[model samples]
Target chain A: MNAGIRLMTPVALLERFRPLFEPRGVVIAGASSHPGKFGFVAAHNLLAAGYRGEVFLTNREGGEILGRETLRSIEDVPAGAADLVFICTPPGAVPELLRTAARKGIRAAFMATAGYGELGEEGKLAERELATLCADLGIVLAGPNGQGIVSTPIDLCAQIVAPIPPRGHIAVASQSGGFVQAFLNYARKTGVGVSRAISAGNCAATAVEDYLEYFADDPETRVSLIYVEGLADGRVFFEKTRRAAAKKPLVVFKGGTTAGGQRAAASHTGALASDDRVFDGMCRQAGLTRATSIEEAFELAASFATHPLPRGPNVFVLTTAGGWGVVTADRISASRELRLMPLPADLRSAFDARLPPRWSRSNPADLAGSETRDTVVECLDLVASHPEVDAVVFLGLGIQSNLGDLERNGPFYPGHGLERVVEFHARQDTRYSELALELERRHRKPILIATELVDCQPENPGPATLRAAGSLAYPSSHRAIGALEHLWRRARRSTAA
Target chain B: MSAGAPPAPSRTLSEHESKQRIRAAGIATAPEMLAADVAGAIAASREIGFPVVVKLCGDGIAHKTERGLVRLGLADEAAVHRAATDLLAAARPADGPVGLLVARMIRGNRELIAGCLDDPTFGRCVMLGIGGVFAEALADVAFRLVPLSARDAHEMIDDLRTQAILGPFRGEPAIDRDAVATTLLALSRLAETSPEIVSVDLNPLVISDGRPLAVDALVEVRGR
Candidate 1:
């Protein structure tokens, strides 16, 4: 039905989205004095997150919220005072307020009001009226029952949510507001930065496809993460997602596959496509990586943000222990896209010359308890530069530091050269983390680092160092292998396209 | 079919009619002929070769094998005549002017299924899967939206879990992927052009000498 919107060019779509994502100023309509109301919380969050733009709040009864004075009506504000408006009023007041805001040159709106579309037939009719009005007014609408939007480039957190995430290159868009917040919370817990994020609640005026198309050409976004429950038009979603994937990696997680889940989705989004098999086929055809869970989706997006695309499927596994190597090799063998290549003679001989006599000189190249400070990085350089290897999964990062912990806690701590040894161990671990990123950039291949992160001490230098360098040390070998497989699939799809 | 007219009630087409429609779309089908009488059936079988298959065919007779109206491996003219006579006698009045279908009996080790359906969300979609008696039980299949490109056809074929069967299996050569892709592409075009066609099912597309031949098919159309 919205055929004209689909025909817009990517450049034009970017400009259309600019006022919503990069607005010069914003007006919070229906601003409340109560702390629990969304009207107050949205303004509080905008001010707390340090939004660097002119913000004007409006209430029917003029008052002061936080510190800014509220106007009696949106008409009291000057024309061109703000380009975006945040509506926290009831559903009945949204249409008239939007009309007034449009007259004042506000081209974008985000509605935090509920009680429409998700209620029933009457609610759906009301939702349709709002969509028609917004279309006629030439305004880009985000949601009628949505949470909010975040733009890190402008240091904007114009939402009713808490915890503005650190700035990075991964952009998130989801049909569920909870998922958008969950991804951002994970970003904060980890050190991954977010460029922009949105929760497309009810999606009455703007669908998830429009956001995907914008992210495709957004210079700040290197990867996009999406969580979808249903779609209004599967073909349009496929086309836009395919176009986006051709430029950068797009990771998707689909919900509502089972019968019970499908019923929930029908009520949740109002239009459900129930065939998971067809959805899987669409993913492969469109070159989008389908993640099985939320954690996997985030990890895949993180991998794309931090690492380079692997040139091929040939993977090399390097481990300090025999079991980690064996498990990693098994996982790679089970994968459809990755292959564990046999170690060539030249590379094997190079490892033999550098490593100790008891090394297990095979594909895994188990260190056999023989490792010095220079051993890991030297062996990594040898394999990563070789023509036979496309990616490397280096396991067991905190081995040396683990031993250092014991000596520091023991009786001889800092007594006879123990302090110097502990400091050297920590510095070496951090250096290793930084060097991995450098090697990945120099060789144009992915080098994933894995260590035990669960129940890990907060002061563990290996993972903390990786986080500081804007890289991730995967918690297990399986996760590392999974991220590497996604990189390889993206590279293959890019080549095919 | 007129655009403004209401759609007619949907019904199944006979096996022979379905094969004819698919063959016209550049898909290979088993060489067969329709006969009205026992003598005509015997002559058609002889022209096709010694060993053949015969079935009572009509629009109303959808499940012939289940109804015991199908005869397989008729090695001679006498067998074809007896089978044709018995099939004709076995048909009920509700079958409505049934005829005997005589065709060559082809043997193959590998079988694949290909078809199209009008999905509610994605419109027409082409499907490829492992086919045989266990097709429903195995449930190994992949799909793509209609109007498939050559690359899409190949990728859908590769998407199937039965990759071993696509290669050399049980003393047979590797299945002809190009031939399979051509069949899928043709079905895509047929689905795109024919709005009245509701669904097309080509089960057990038998691979004889590395080439897929549509030994049996059923096409559902919008009108009686």
Candidate 2:
């Protein structure tokens, strides 16, 4: 472990990864004119995403692709013209093409080809050979059967997939290409942009741990989300993850944890130490937040990206209705990471003066359907600024907006001065969303606004406004609490460390 | 004797030897003494006080309880002598040299297991879990790669799902968590220092009066 630390110093790792992530020039080998091939998609996405760097294309019989002239071969490309190459050729053709690219001074290569280790014995042997070759040539290889790479900082979406996510600070890496794409899709839909996303297909040369180490120090990355199936070396993974987690939060979701997937053991201790249990222990020891599901993993990543690290586990749940508060309070009671801080005398008195007499007057602070725009915003500020609270989950967004939608679309259209009433409600919802962001900044506490977002229309003013403000109003109170629990656990682990 | 049979590849240490090995590494075990004869067993039991356990002890005798070579709750000198005679009589020809292990009879409602194993992927790892006859059935365990820090030891104890049992239970005090952590740390160090030891099972580290005392232990070592 000491040797690993000495060999891969942070400065050395950052330097090693600069060309792959922040390349000055990039080349697309096997660039195709056909719109169907991965070769064409790789080049097209790179160009379309507005990568601010020189781009070169090469093919055996190259002429023009996306209006850029393509060289006939890697040899035709000028030396030092590009520092990175995306190999989109067949598996058998990759080795020779990589050799030519290495000669052409390409320091990094991403093999966007398939048919490597995912096959059986023969494919594994070939993958090992490719790894050895990359080491010998001193070329940083990303994948032998990967989808591609997306580095938003460089405006480089050099992948075979579509929908480059909006720019944000979460770096995502996955052993499964499809899952990486799924996370990117979530980012695009939720306005939760990613700083970097990579599909570590086969991980022949550059494994997931390498990316984790880089993201640990990557200036643009604030959080990392990873999806793993199995590890080649558990101890090495544990050490690297522990080091990375000390610097930034890491959200992990692993597959194949059931009893059916466990290996047989010879001793009593070994029998009880199932793969899942060991992995769980590793996560706790390394201070990584292990999510049980894919959605939870992404939500945790989003929370880390948007919210400040909570000072402690004391949580304040603010709601506009009674039922939302009731269910959310129940969740807090069950959570091991967070506590529902009781409403102190001073804050209770303040709420008593402003809120209706029917209010529950507890930790949830149920507003009981008697809140105006000013009262809601005031209550949020009161709770956020209170010294006892570390975080707040504000439920009941989109309520007024949804009501406005119903009234505006109903039969008494503009009859009872309804037009102005609908407009006022929409404006109030948007203002509350913006105020949540502001109060969060001022108090350095997370104020997670949630509503039944799945039931809301695409243009619902509440969620739309939060998204436009570069934040997210979660879909439900359960999800909001779950995300907050992850954040608090991460904060506690960091504090303990 | 015929010189044709080869010795066993690996051997399970006798209970006396196993306890000694772990006790040297700072693990607490029940007070006991190895007696070479019935008279010696009576003397050892007297020193250990009333209500002692006498078991057949030898390297060749691994599963003494299954073979009916163990006698528990011997309250006096006559009981100890009778149990010791029966155990020695039950010993088989293959048992080689044997002795009587007289230990203070330990009783507890709660049991915990602590051991170390050479995992195929994670290498040497120490395990802590709820123990007893239903240990495998309950399957509540936590593991850490060996050479555990103090923090790791405490966290492992906290990771058990049946945490209610760790608290004050059945009119007894809460299990001494720091003592359990110490035992885990000791096992971790023992595993690190003794690579020849393939695995160690200290099941039923019986909790009595809020403290853990190992009543039975088996240390499986590689090669004779």
Candidate 3:
């Protein structure tokens, strides 16, 4: 019943990796007392996140570590006590420990150790043996050298980092440890929480496609965000990813698009990215959306998760600043998929009642520096409620610091000082969030916001407010319009498939 | 698939034989007969109707237009005879004489090229593109892996960069899109079922009124 997608992999092999995604009982090999060590932190993450399963700590000394009794050897742990083993030992010790894991019948592994295949030929042999032994033992491994894994559905945070982003729909899996780390951090900053995130380093026994297959079935995951520096098996990756994308959105951010990036990727993950144009052709056939950068990838993920699918090409641009609107319009005009709508007669009358006489009423309705909260709400209602408009993009609405100048509009300020001014602006931010959510909910159209306020500013509540309300704000109008374009294109591609 | 390694390319089929092979696969090909003499050419012209097209058809004789071996819009028996004599004499300087390929002249504003190639990485794939004089000048083409479903055929036509040509243009009725899709589907089946036919090239897939008629074709086969 699949439309043009190729299904692959043996059913048994596919099932073997399930424990890696949702393990019931996990144990840490080489669990340490030292706070700085990876084993200690990996254990700490699980405990901190309140993982709802049995967690075992194995140390050679057989003492208590992380308030749990350590198992001196694999034999010390009871039979079938652990379904997943996180091997944190050096490369040379991995072979012997894997033998014990096989005897113990641990179905899955998340190896945190480094210095394996990625180092050189000798290390490659070790990685190859690791793969062969796992296969021989009927075991599926996440990595021989990896950052770690996070399963938000099971409340399992088994990575070295703790306090991962709050639970949400987007699932991320990538070969670059840095990309996964950056994604998780961005998720927290933007409140774009992840269903699951994996830094699939080296990928010896388990490949990237294995995680794609897992996320495809995860009900919590609405879309899969993949960062690719290179692919181990282009054929299998294409087959599985296309199949996954056919079911849901698969937004791919390819790192090795340039010669410099390709070399860096080779050194980082020991992978040679495919030729740019050839890889592009393959993605087009598979119906996958390609984001040019990690930021765009996350922006697109959040946009898709928040907005309803845009059904037509006509887009309504509402901007507080005319220059920002023109810049965004220029960017939108570069793409053929989206178009600027003519100013509807109803919209003209509505804006005329709210704004001064100088408003440009042609197509992209520029508010001409009216930062008033009522102006945005009325414009959003008029544009989103219009029959011909498919999506509305708002620009330069987050610069509420303009409200601090008491001479300009000080009467509106809740009486004096920078602190009161901030409180007043926060109220405006909440109102914008509510207005955006209400309009989108009623109209079933996408609403993208742009702000000039610094995302890192402590006083700025725009990004967090919008994020909490299940919407997102871009730092620039270009990104906001670009994300809207991608969302529309993604919806079309999904439905067509 | 063949029994052993794929055979080497020997030569391309004559246009007449190529048309016959593809027409057997359910493609609507214009009727044509190869004439060896002036009398035979006139007879073929009479049988095919008033205006006829004449071209020198032979193995390894590619790009007959630049070689000036093709004559179109020959209106009568005298015109057909004169064109056939010129084409037959032109064949002498080339890969030698085969015959004068005579067929009913087709007049259409839009031209398209459709073909199949055994791509190295993708295997058997079908290609559809805007053709005629601008084929090489503008490579507005789209490719799809073969055993093409109806949807694939439909998408393949829309995938062309110069999309305006597919619709009603120059006051002519819109080319029958369903027939074009059927042509692609039939060609895909021909490639999949016939392993000996390694590739095919049908240029000037003339859109006359609202239908597609294969005016010229070439099929490459294995072995000498």
lDDT (Cα, tens digit) per residue for candidate 1, span A121-214 = 8988898888999999989998878899999998888788867998988999988888889889878866788999998888898888789889
Q: What DockQ results do all the predictions give, each relative to the true complex?
A: 0.45, 0.37, 0.08
lDDT of 3 by residue, B1-224 (tens): 42123556556888888998999998887878888888898998999997999888888687888888789899988898788887777666557558888899998999998988764434566778888888999978777666777877887776677877888899889989899999999999999898888899989799889788899898998878
Q: Write the per-residue lDDT of candidate 3 for residues A215-332, one digit (tens) a residue.
A: 7777778889988777765655667777888777888888878899889888877766765644654566676788888888888887776678888878888877788888878887
Model 3 gets an lDDT of 0.78
Q: What is the TM-score of chain A in candidate 1?
A: 0.96
Candidate 1 chain B, run of 10 with poorest lDDT: B1-10
User: What TM-score results for chain B in every one of the models?
Assistant: 0.95, 0.93, 0.93
What lDDT score is found at residue A321 in candidate 1?
Answer: 75
Chain B global fold similarity (TM-score) for predicted model 2 against the true chain B: 0.93
DockQ, 0 to 1 scale, candidate 3: 0.08
CA lDDT, candidate 3, residue B193 = 93
Candidate 2 docking quality: incorrect, acceptable, medium or high: acceptable
Clashing pairs in 2: none
RMSD in Å for all candidates: 2.3, 4.6, 5.5
Q: Please identify which of the two predictions, 2 or 3, would achieve the higher TM-score against the true structure.
A: 2
